[model samples]
Structures are given as structure tokens and as C-alpha cells.
Target: MTAPLLEPPGGRPLRIGSRTSLLATVQARHVAELIHEYAPGVATEIVPIRVSADVWDGDLSRIGGKGAFSKEIDRALVAGEIDVAVHCMKDVPGDVPLAEGTAFGAYLERGDVHDVVVTRDGTPLADLPPGSVVGTGSVRRRAQLGMYRPDLRTERIRGNVDSRLARLNEDGSGYAALILARVGLDRIGETAQPQEVLPLEFHQADEGVVSMVPAVGAGVIGVQARQRDLAVMSLLGGLNHDQTARHILAERSMLHELRGHCNSPIAGYATTTADGAMSLHGMVFNRDGSELVRFHCSGSPDDPAALGSEVAAELLRLGARRLIDATGG
Candidate 1:
């Protein structure tokens, strides 16, 4: 039986906060759609807010790392200007806790966790010429690229997905390729055909040679609201996917324990099995990817946090701390 829809006070539409980017807007609208599906009579309004990270063209670490992406929207949410804030889980910093008054209301089902390499001439990553330059802003991606093809070079590229693609397509951009999250492309409807889509498996012959470990919370959308707003929390709870939440909880547990930041060359992913077990895979790398520390652990899905912590502890014991500290994380 369907419960009565809980409309906001005074019958006002819930204002959904989002970064003023096309991709962010799309994600915000998707959340609105989910709300409508969950409660046919409830209303939602997406409010676009420009964040510091959008205007800052320099290194993100200089301006509080990836947290810059959500600070403004979080402020608006806390100030009661917005009812909910939509965020890409990967953009949410793990080194610190969420804002004092904010809490994640729900996490949508996960998307494609693998990354894709886009080349101008449709050349595969392995086929790229030596000394070719790949473009990315993530230290993790840069390190992994170095591990996969030491002969290649990487240049930092930052902007919205479309702008990055534009830069890659420009003449003399010097970007032989750009590595992007597959889910980001899918969200903005930009991924028609990519040169090479990397897989999540580790050295699986049929998938690909390079095993690209995804960032914690990659390919997930998190909806956050005031921790004290019981009504809003109740409305969003219906949208949460239990399996995805478990996986994310495990991954985030490891990230939080490791204190990974934007500049940190850290990657972790979590998966669940049909038998109610979960496993977390974690890795830390040096800036140039010349060295790596990897660990994996499995446990009951009911205690995902413990499994993630176990993996993180093992990785740290294997000297991941040295690599992370070297990057100033």
C-alpha cells in the first residue's frame, strides 16, 4: 500500500541545490524526478549555485581541495536557502566529515564505475605513441596512467566535461587523450563512443590489461539535507538503494580512515556478493605511479565499515602512508 505523500511545509516545493554546471544540473533534475516517482504530489525546484571550484582554474588543493565543489551549496543548504543538495560522491572529500548540520539523505543506485579513455583519432590507449600526453586532473589517474604506460606523459586538465572535450579537440591542445569517468559521460549524454573504456577488474584478460581502481564513491549521486529535517530525510530515504549504500559505506569507511584528499593518490572500490558478503579493494600510489600499495579484504555486508577499515589498515601497514604524505594529503 502507498503511504500518503509528505509534502513540504505550507505546500512549498522543495528547492534542490546544485552546482551551476550542465552535468550537475542534469543530476539535480534526475533527483527531482526520483522524488516525483517516490511521491507523486511532492514538488521539487532545482537551484543552481556557482561554487569556488568552478571559477578557480588553478590547482584544487590550493582552495581546500575537492570540498570546494560543495562548500557553497552546502552553505545554502545549511542557511535554509535550499532543501537538499545534490553532489557527486567522488567530489565529496573524505579527509573530513560533512558539514556540521548536513547529512546524506540517500545515495542513488551506482552507475558505471569504470573510466574511459578518449582519443582524438579513436586510438586505443595501448596504441598511443610513446611520449603521448594524457590529460586529467586527478592524481590517482595520473599515477595509474604512469603505472600502465610509463612512456606516456600527463598534463592537468580541468573544467566541465564539455570544456575538457573541447580542449582535447582543439588543435595543438597537446592532449593525446583524456581519461574521464564513464558515468559522467553517461549523465551528460556525451559518451557516444569512446576510444577505450577501461574495466574495474584487476588484470582480467578479456576486459583490459590495465586495472583502473575507481575513486571512493565514484559513479554515485548523494542527496544531502539538514540533519534535523526529519520530513525531508523521510522523503529521501525511500530513494536509497541498499546494495549501493552498503558498497559506498565500505569504500568511504576506508577513505575516511586513510584521510585521503584531492591530491592524494588514493583509489578504493567496494563490491558485494550474492551471499551477503562485501569486499573492498584499496590502493595508494606515488605521484609518478612508480610505486603502489594495494590491499583487499572481505567481510559480512552487514559490517561494511569494518571490512573497509581492515583494507585500509592493511594498505597503511604496507606503506601507503608514505605515498599519501608525499603528496601533501
Candidate 2:
């Protein structure tokens, strides 16, 4: 049996590497607190590192969107600079990359995987004033928003959650509303106060789900100590959230089959139901969501990755490949 250890390496203060942003720190601290609670003797610490990705000089295209943020932390892990690296699962890419013979280990309880829209005055998106400005950097979000409000103006806004929130003004000068992910708001404890919390089903990324796209091999975050460092892995095993792993597998598999990147207008999400089966919702769009094509896969659900692959295959057959190739996705 793959029995997990009750406690991590004791007496040694384990360092958890993470970005310095408020959201990143909060997530890192949460994991640290859990470890301290589980193993009283095991000390914990947090290391803040700066990545070039966060220094947005107005051009998000060159700074390397999501992967740029994770590659540095992953390097630190490889060098054993930290016992483990804490990360937002969505920021990671689809594949896991480590020196050959190495592998990613575990993940945390997933946050709201869906995306949400934040409009002014707690009003539903439909109620937003005509010509409302919705801000987001995700091609998926923009495409979906365009589908709903053909007249609405969508702009690219980047920065930490708070940074983006700062741009939402009391005066109407700023964008009427900002489009943000629900999980991020919840993590920073700002879920309720932020303007209109657009329902996700219609908004694409809603409350209760996170649109995950982890850097290759970054989906898992339990720990990556060497084989000789079994103690660290043992301690991290206790922190593992099995359902989180399943969701990562299902979501990442869709990206893998589709072979998408920042440019690719491909999107996918996986959900675990009461019956313990998985449901996958996927879509591929052109520059505009008007040409959007979506489909869902349902089956034993135990084979989430397989189900995701099957869906990608179907999309490719349905001309998704031609769409991507033609659009430079």
C-alpha cells in the first residue's frame, strides 16, 4: 500500500518557496500553517523570490505570461533551495518538466475553478450599463465575454488581484467593471465586496471552480525532495489533496491533447460529481468567441485524463486543428 507518513522531517525548519505577491503569500502561508498544525515539531518558513514575469512593462506578451512566473521557482526546487514550492495551480502549464528521473508529487485542495466577472454595484452583468468595460488578460475570458456582450469593450489588465482591483474606480473614469477569477477573490478574502460577482456558468469561469492551466509538471506541490530526501516527501504526502490531483490530471490532459499555449484559444475544465465521476467541459475559439465550439465528456469519470484526451481528439476531428493552425494558436 502507498501509505503516507504521518509527519515530515522533524526538527528541520522546511522552507516553502513562493512569489511575494499577496495572493501567493496567502497561499504559501496556508500550506505552512497546515504543516505546522499537522507536525508540531517540524518548523516552517517562507522564501519570497521575484520573477521577471511580474515586472510588467506594459507588454505581457514578451514577459512570458504564466510559465515565466513558475520556471524560476521550479529551478529553486531543482537546486534544493527550498524543500517545496507553493504555487497557484492555474498558473502552472500543462506539462511537468524536471530533470529526467524526477517527477512532481502532490497538490492542494483546489479553489473555485470557474472564472467570475466583477461588475459595479453587485449588479448582474446583464444589468451593467451599456458599453461597460470588462478587463481581463485571458484570451478565453475575453472571447467568452465578447460572445455575451457584443457591444461591451474588453481590455487587457494585468497585475496582482489587488493591483487590478485598484484600477476599478469609485468614479466611472476607470473601466466600468473588471473580470477576475472567483478563486483569487476568495483566496484574498475579497469575494463579496467587489462590485458585481458575475455568475460563472454564463461567465465561463464562475464561483466554485478554477480554470486551471499549470506550468508543465507544476500541478502537484506537495514536495520534490530527492529520493534520498524521503522525509520531505513523506511530510508533503500528508498535505496532499487527492481530488486536487484528479482535477489537475483531467485539466492538464485536455491541454496536452490540444497542445495549447498562451496564444492558443483553447480552454478546458474538469469537475468531479457526487457519483464520483468526472465531467469535462472544453472549448476552442477563434480570436472572437462568436465562432466558439464547445463539448462535454461524460463516462466512468475515473479515467479523467482518458476522457479529456478523447474530447481533444473529437475537437481535432471537428476541425479544431485547422482552426488553431489558421489562427496561429
Candidate 3:
């Protein structure tokens, strides 16, 4: 038998907090829909909040690192301005602890985890002219690109997907291509063609085939609420996707163990099998992709964190710390 749905305090509509960006609002609405499905009669409201990362035109590291994206929303959550907060797991910094008094109540099912390339004319990455410039904000992506195409140069590009696409379309924009997460583009209704999807392995002229590892928590959405709020937690718990949650746990565990920061060129992906086993792949790279260390391992799904830590330990032993510290991450 299903349990009775707990009503919000005072019978008010449950308010969901999200960033002001169109993508953020869309994601928040998705969460609201999930809530509605879980409790047919429950009422929900979306609250758009502006975050520091959105307003700051300068480098994100200058403000408060990656937390700039979530701090304000977290503050609202802690202050009772909203009942729940939605976040893209990839944007959540792995090195730092989450906001005090708050914890993630659920992680939505994972989405397409592959990164895709968007070019002006749908050109394959390898066919691009030598010295052509690619734009991306991720150190991990930049480093991987360096490893893949030493002749190609990378410029830092920041903004939401639309703005980035606009930059790519601008007359003077030097970007020959922009690499983005496939899921983000799909969510925003900008699906990439099959040829544009970057393969997991690419042929590097001299180095043979190289693999592009995805960032930790790349394709997951996390729902957060105050830890002590039983009603909210109970409500949000129903939305958790067990397999996705396990993968996030393993990936995040590896990230936490590595002490990776926004500047850290770290990538990790975790997967679970139907047999209750899990595998994690972790990699760390230098700023320019001149150095890299990677490790992979399998373990019991019951202890995802342990598996993540094991991979992290292996990476550290292989001199991942030196590469991470060199970038001052």
C-alpha cells in the first residue's frame, strides 16, 4: 500500500529553487513534474534565483570557485525561501563540502553522458584545419583536446549554451568548434547530429587511439533540501534513480578523494551492472594535457564510495597529485 503524501508546512505549495537561466528553469520544471507525478495532488511553484556565476563576467575562480553557481540557491534553501533546489551535478564542486545543514535528497536518472562537438559546418574534429581554434571553458576538455590535436588551439569560452552558440555564430568569433555536453543540448532542444557526437575513442596521429573521459557527475541532476526537513526529504526521495544515484556516488567519491577543484583537470565516469557490480574510470591531467594519469577498477555496488576511493588512490599513486597541484586546483 502507498503511504499518504505529506503536505508542505501550512499546506502551502512546495517551492522549488533554480537558477534564472532558461535551462535551469526548464530543469526545475522537470523536477516539479516529477513531484506532481509522485504526488498527484501536490502543488509546486518554481522560484528563479540569480546566482553569482551568472552575473560575474570575470573568471569563476575569482569569486568562490564553482560554488558560485549554487551558493545563492543553497542559501535560499537554508533560509526556507524554497523547499527544494535543483542542480546540475557536474557544476557541483567535488572538492568542497556541500552547504551546511543541507544534503542532496535525490538524483534524477542519468542522461546522455557523451560530449559533442558543434562546428560551423559540421566538420569532423580531425578534419579541421591545423591551428584552428576551439572554444571551451572546461580544463578537462581543453586538456583532452590538446592530447588529441596538438596543432589545434583552444580559447576559453563561457556562458549558457545559447550564448556560447551565439559566440560561435558571431562574425568575428575565432572558434572553429565548440564542445558541449550532449544532454545539455538535448534538454535545450538543440540535438546534435550523429556525426557531430564525439566518439569515446579518437585516433591521435602518433599516439594511436585516445579515450575522452567524461567529468564526474556529468549527466545527472541532483535535488537538494535541508537535511532536517523530513517532509521534503521524504517527498524528494521518491524521485531518486537508484542506478544513477549509485553511479553519482561512485564518481563523486572518487572526486572527493582526489580533492579535485574547478581548475583540476579531472574526469571520471561510473557505471553499474544488473549483477550489483560497479566500475569506475578516473583520470587526471595537466593544464596543457602534457601529462596524464588514469586508473580503472571494479567493486561491489553496495559500496560505491569505496570503489571510487580505490580508483582515486590508484590515480594518486600514479602521480595524479602532481598534475593536479601544478594547475593549482
Candidate 4:
């Protein structure tokens, strides 16, 4: 027999896992708020965990850190220590690497995913003076910028969103800009610093929707207490942005096929028409972002993932594979 959805478990509150970071906590609270608004009677408990990626002195460039922020919470999920864990979708690894029996329950509506340029002077990228060094931790940003201005240099940066912004806001004489996540900026209310946010449709890789990319089955927060956790699922799934899911599915599949790594200079986006026809766009670039190959495929949302994979194969045939091998990403 299954327990009631909102039965006054008056005994104990349901626990949800969250990271110890301020931003992670904020995301958890956002998720919790949604639950409280929709699912009555069930209380949420926050389980904070530490992750290695929170290094105080480690160089993000040297660590090759992928999923550094998510591994610990994922472990807690797999171990049955927490009911659900909230996460940033892009931070999720290409493959859900968690133990069986544990899965992501559903996705929250996504946020923007474009890389933004935050210049201290609020100047556009094109206006940056010569020899301007751009601060960014992402190779994608580095490559994209390189494509536009090979004269610009990429400086390795590390830390939470706040910390990165601090570095950008701080003087790096000759430093013209920093690449940041549009979602992060909006979440923290700091979108004013950058002169412009790239529109994914206009800029090869710009700001756009987010998607829940949980470890396998964890696409949504795995509100698992028992097999019939339907009420919890319904409340959250009701928030699923269908277009976001289609975009992410196609993007993830493309990443999987192209072997897109954390450091790979890869970009993908999906958009939909009023009639619901889905158009998927993806690209693979060399480390310098100088050599880029783009491909697009359209289909019904029914098989966006297949469409993504098909385009990826076409990209590979056109020489994207050689660039990946050369970059070792």
C-alpha cells in the first residue's frame, strides 16, 4: 500500500538534498517553495552536502572538474539519504552516473543557458579595446570569443558565480570582459553589469532556456519514497516546460554522439514554432572556436533526441571528429 500524498506525516518532514553553497541553497528553496505551494501537508527538510569542487584554492583549469558540484548530492540520492536533489542542468554530466533504483523525478522549468559577456565598463564585446583579455572558466566561451577576436586572450578563472563576477569586476587591466551564465546572472540579480546578453538565435551560442539533466531517471527531482510517488511527480511534472525538454533532449543527444566533454567547444540549441515543429541547431568548434561546423535538423518533439543524433553524425562526417581529437576534449 502507498502512503497518502499530503497525509500529515506529522511525524517527520520529507528531506531534500542541497549543496552547502548559497546558490545551491537558493535553488533548493526555489524547488521547496514550488512544492509547498502545490503539495500541501508535506514539509521539506534540507540536507546540505559538501563537494570537492568547492575548493578554496584549486585552479579550475588544472582540475578538469566535471560534475564536481553534483557528485556528492547524487551519491546521497543513490544511497537513499535524500528524497530529491536540485541541480543546475548544465552541470549534470552527459550521462546520469548514479546507482540503479535512483532516478531524477522531473524537471523544473529551465532558466537561460547562454554565455553572457560581463564587462566592468558595460561595453559590448565588439567595442573592447585591442589586446583585451577575457576572463572565463569555460572553453566554450574562450573558443567563441576566439572566433570573433583572436586578439583577445582567455584567462582561467574559478569560483562560484559571485566569485567569478568579482574577478571580472575587479581590474584585470586590459581585461575587457567575462563570460557568465545568463541564468546565474538573473538568479543573482546582476544582469545589469553586462552591456548585452547574446540571443542564442543570433549568437551561435547565446542565452536561452534550461532543462533538467539529472543522472539517469533523475531528469526531474526523484521524489522517491516509494514506487507510487505520483502526487509529488504530478505537482512537479506540471511545471515541465515541454519546449525546454525537447531542446535539452536534442542537445544532450548531440553531446552524447559528438562525445561533447566539459571542455569541448560545442554548442546546441532547439527552438519551436507555433505549430510545434521543432528546429534543432548544433555546432562543434575547434579549441580556439576558430573552426566551427554547424548543422540543424527539424522534427516533431516526438523524436528530438534522434534528430540531434542524426545531425551529430553529419557533423562528424564533415570533420568535427578531427577537431575533437585535436583538442583532446
Candidate 5:
């Protein structure tokens, strides 16, 4: 028989696994708050787990790529160290499967789903001069920047959001602009910086200058727990935002169908209409943005995964896989 959802448990507070970074801690704390709100008196603790991506101090692609960030937390979950784990959904890989007995149980409400361009002096993308160095580690961003302004050179950047912004805010011969996630900025409360935050739809140099289809599950926080953990699952299920989960699942399914890595230069976004239909926009680009493929599909929100897979299939039929492979993502 299943245990009651709110049967006063033992003295141990439910432990939550999360990364140690400031932004990660903030997200984890938010989840903890939600759990407390949903089940008053259900104690919870935050457990910080170190990850390979945080310690590799080198190229992630050459190491383990996106999985490096969440693998440790997942391990904690599998090892019985943490009752639940919070994740920046984008860090969860599409190609790498999850550990046995573990799965995402809920998705917190979504946040801003667009990447913002931050410039040293709030200069619009078009105003930037040729040969300007833009710092970013994302292949998609690099390719999109090339597509917009081929003359601007790109330098690989790796660090937490704050560190990246600090480097750009400092006076140096470093990047003139940095491409960062707007959601992250808001979470960290660093939106008041002197840099300009350009809208995803902002046009300057050319049509679709900075395409922002968004990474799959970009602004969502996922709560993960052992599938059979009835108590944890029940508690988190109360916090799940059905609409956000549907959108993320659709995006994730589209990514999975392409056999693309989570860190691949692929971008996809899904939105639900008032009438309960889901529409997905997906894009695939070669390493240099020399080639581009874009597609869209709509379906009932009740079957987001199917809609996502269908869109991905259409994209692949049009040679999306070829473009994805060329990037080595």
C-alpha cells in the first residue's frame, strides 16, 4: 500500500541536491521554498554537489559536455544521498540517458525564454564594429552571430554568468559583447548592469540577425527524484506546472528525435495557445551558420511529445541531421 502524501514522516528532512554556484543555489532555494509552501512542516535541506563541468577547467565538449554539469547530482540521487535534485533543464543531455531509477518528476514554472545580447556600452548589435570579439561558448550562438555579422570574430568563453559578465564589464581588451541567457540574469538579479539587453526580436544589421529559437528547456527548472519515491514524487507533483512541463517535453522530444546532444547548436521553443494547442519552432545550423534549417508544427497540448517528434522528423527529412553532424555538437 502507498504511504499517505502528508503522513508525518521521520525526523530527517528531505535533502535536495544542487550545484554550488550562486545561480544554482538560488534556483535550488526556490524549489525548496515551493516544497515548503506545498507541504507545510515537511522539512527540506539543500545539498550542494560538485560537478565535472565546474571543475574540469577546460573544454567541456572534449570532456563530457553537457552531462558533466548534472551527472554528479544524479549520482547523489542514485546513491540515496539526496531525496530530490533540482536542475537547469538545459544541462540535462538529450543523448545521454539518465541513471536507472531516476527521472524528472516536475517542472517549475518557466521564466524568460530568450537569450539576451549584452554589450559593453549598450550598443545595439548592428552598431558593433567589424572584428569585434564576441564571447560565447554556445555553437548555436556563434553560428547565429556569424550569420548576422560574419565580420565579428568569436572567442570561446567559459565561466559562471557573473564571471562572464564581470569579464565583459571590466576594462580590458576582452569581449566587446557577451551573449547570455536573460533568465539567468533575472534569477541572479544582475539586470541593472550598464550593458544593454537586446530583445530577441530586435533587428539591426539584417533579417533574423540574432535568431533566438531558445535551447530546449531553456528557462525551466526540473525536479528529479527516484521514480519509486512516492513521498518525494507526491510532494513535487504538487508543484508541477503542467503547461511548462508540456512545453519542455515537446522541446525535449524534438531534440531527442534529432539524436542531438543537449549542448548541440540546435534551438527549439514551444508555446501553448489559449485554446490549448502547442506550437513548436525549431532550428538547426551548421558550425558556421553557413547552412540553416527551420521548421514548425502544431498539435494538441495533450500530445506534445508526438508533435515535437513529428516536427523533428520533418526537419531531419530536410537534412537537419547532416547540419547537426557538421558542427560536431
Candidate 6:
């Protein structure tokens, strides 16, 4: 493995690799601001990297799923071209482990993790006209929405946040509602009021009970660095949020245990309880949401990985692997 320099050659600012999307640049700037706040006088520059997944024309699953978004940035890190890489945690796939010598060094504080329904003129999801079309790119969102509201049609929509919103805002766009991540909308300052902020907690609905379990590692920003870059990692450590790191670590561990792919509808979330115990919940669903295998476990905060693994094992025993195979997840 190539050992990255302790400092950039010629005293150049440390390069932080980020995706070229607007939302990604926003996240990159946020992290840069935090870095500047924590470690003053450390010159840093945001280096945008174009990822294949961002430019791919076909469905995400066919192009290698969410991991595709991070591969190039990770390559840049491994190649010593960048000191660190910033990524939306949800886009890092569970099946593909980080490259050797690279480690997740810090996690920003958690943000709003729930998905939301944004509609033209702000029509509530339930109140939308019957047979109305809803747009989203996530299979998990599609399955859940179908289960929650079978009367509505779920269609695949793709683009950066602004482009997707444009499609929704344009007159006669044919979409009654759009499912989007609340954090993404908030990050970009898009104030299209959410028709409904889907709750994570279970509740009774007209089409039976429903809950919106977030994608694993959702609402978190991950800072990755070369393991040997002690200087960079030390600087990043100052920006780490311990509580958020614990939660994301458990979530990622569960994802690794599940080995769930992008093609599968897998959701996992971890949080602390009132007494400070760490609890993890993992769910696996069939394509149509007809069958679900859900499991939960709690453990000491110090051993969050164990808690996540335990819950994942239980879900697997309940046929999670079967669903994954059936759906190529």
C-alpha cells in the first residue's frame, strides 16, 4: 500500500475529494466548514470527483448500485490523490467493504433521517387524487409506498435534487407526489413543504399498519481517510460526533452482516434508548412488500457492533437471505 504523505507536497492545501453534485458540494462545504472550525490554519480544498454512478444512464442496480457513487472517490483516497473523502453514508453499499488501508475516520452529527412526500401545491400523500403517480428512485421507498398506498402508482425518477424538483414543479409534470430524503431537501434549501413526513415509529393507517425505517447509515456524513494518515485522521477526529458515530457504526455493521445488496429492500436503524442502551432494528422486505422479516436487539453502547450483528442474524434466520437472493439484493 502507498503511504500518503503526512502533509501535502509543497505545502499545498489538503485535498478533500467530493462528488460534483450540488447536494454533494453542499455537504462537502459543510464538512469543510467544520474542519476549518476545528482546526484553524489547516489549508483545505474541495476536489470534486465525477463518479460513474452519477452519470450512468441505466438503473442503479445494473450499474453496481450505491457503491458506484463512492468507488472513484475511494480510489482517489487509496491513490493518495486526496487526503480524505466525504460521502453520504446511505450511498455506501453494505456488500462492498472499504478498500484496504482506508478507514471511516469521522461521522458528522445525525440529521433528519425520515423520508418525505413532496407534492405540487402541497397535496398530502393520502389526499392525492386516486391513480396519481408518485416518483422516486429508491426500491425501498417504492415498496413501502406501494404497501402503504396501493391506490397510488410508484414510478422511478432519477436526477440531482434540483432536477427532480424541477420535474415535480413544472406544470403538467404528471406526478402527484415525489418521495425524497428530508435531509437532502433541507441541505439544498428547497422549501417545498412536505405533504407528509413519514414517521419511523409504527402506527395504524388505512392500508394496515406502517412504519418508515430509514436506510442504513442515512442522515450521516462519513469522512474516510487512509489508515496510515495519522496526521489527517487526528484532525478529523476533532470533528467526530461520538453519539452519531455510535449509531452509524451499529447501522453499518448490521448492513455488513446482512450483506444486503442495492437490489434488495433492506432498512436498518440504530439509536439510543432513554436509559442510554443502544438498540438496533433491521428489516428485509420482498419486492412487493408482501413478506417482511424484522428483528430488533439491544446491547451496551460500547458494543454496538455486536448488537447490530445479533439483530441481523435474527433477520437472516427469518429468511432475509432468501429474499435477497430472489431480488438479487
Question: By lDDT, who's the top model here?
Answer: 1
- Give the alpha-carbon lDDT of every model: 0.88, 0.66, 0.86, 0.65, 0.82, 0.85
Candidate 1: tens digits of C-alpha lDDT, residues 92-152: 9998778888899899999999889998778999889999999998898898888878889
lDDT of 6 by residue, 215-258 (tens): 99889999999988888888788788999999988988888888
How does candidate 2 fare on TM-score? 0.84
TM-score of 5: 0.94
* Runs of candidate 5 exceeding 4 Å displacement: 1-10, 195-205
Candidate ranking under lDDT, highest first, comes to 1, 3, 6, 5, 2, 4
C-alpha-based local distance difference test score of model 5: 0.82
User: Model 3 segments beyond 4 Å from truth?
Assistant: 1-4, 192-195, 201-210, 274-276
- Tell me the lDDT of model 6 at 67: 81
TM-score of 3: 0.95
lDDT of 3 by residue, 1-329 (tens): 24247788898999999999878988999999988888878899999999999877666788888899999999999899998999999999998888899999999999988888888788888788999998888889989888878889988888788788889989988889988888888888876443377665434537644346788998899999998988788888888999899999999999998998889989999987667689888989998887888888899988998999899999999999889889883
Candidate 1 pairs with clashing backbones: none
Off by over 4 Å in 4: 1-10, 56-64, 95-98, 171-174, 202-235
List where candidate 6 sits over 4 angstroms from the true fold: 1-6, 204-210
User: Please, what are the lDDT tens digits per residue for candidate 5 over residues 189-261?
Assistant: 9887655444444234366456555788889999999988887787778888999999998999998889886
Q: Against the hidden reference, what TM-scores do the models get?
A: 0.96, 0.84, 0.95, 0.84, 0.94, 0.94
Error of 2 at 16 (Å): 0.5
In model 3, the worst 10-residue window by lDDT is: 201-210
Candidate 5 residue pairs in clash (backbone atoms < 3 Å): none
Pick by TM-score: which candidate is best? 1
- Candidate 1 lDDT score relative to the true structure: 0.88
- Writing each residue's lDDT as its tens digit, candidate 4 over 1-329 gives 23246542445666778878667777788777767766656688888888767774454334444667676777787666776777766666563343455555556655655556788767877777778887876666677777667777788776787877776666544456777776666776766675466555434333322111111111222232222455545545654566667667777787778876666667667768778888777777788876878777888888988888888898898888887778763
Model 3 residue 96 CA deviation in Å = 1.3
